[model samples]
Target: MKKHEGLNCDDCVEHLYTYLDGELTGETESDVRVHIEGCGDCFGHFEFERTFLRFLEARAKAQCAPEPLRRRIFKEVLLDNGSEAE
Candidate 1:
């Protein structure tokens, strides 16, 4: 395995979406996991990113209103846009 110095926070941030979505394949995922485990700075960055993603997920869930409210908003908001009327 490489010494992990060559990779930095930028690299970690860039790959974070892929890592969370499980898009990384064999060796790349292994390398990222190793770097996160060994490097405190990179690990902190990863933790922050992970927590941010979780917060976004929670916010999205919270923003999802009840079905009647969703329907009312959709009809009042989206249906007001006349572009799709044709």
Candidate 2:
């Protein structure tokens, strides 16, 4: 792994989300990637976050509510707010 001359644990943690989401620019991404590779703790945190995002993605794909269920929820929300679902 190439060493990121100025990257450190704090910087890596600060940009973890952006890094995982592929929102970082090329240079920033490289720095964060290198930092994570050399820092065990940061790497573990990155892995955990990555796994969590994947789990959420899979769960969302698998558990989409049907149209009827969505309508029911919308009606329920309207009723809960004292507005009838006409």
Q: How well is each residue in 1-86 modelled by candidate 2, as lDDT tens digits? A: 54447587887899999999989997888888888888899999999999999999998889667999888877777566565434
Residues forming the 10-long window of minimal summed lDDT in candidate 1: 1-10
Determine the backbone clash count of candidate 2.
0
Which ten contiguous residues of candidate 2 have the minimum total lDDT? 77-86
Candidate 1 clash figure, as a count: 0
Q: How many residue pairs clash in each candidate at the backbone level?
A: 0, 0
Score candidate 1 by TM-score against the native. 0.60
Q: Which candidate is the best by lDDT?
A: 2
For each of the candidates, the C-alpha root-mean-square deviation to the true structure, in angstroms, is 6.2, 6.7
**lDDT score of residue 6 within candidate 2:** 55
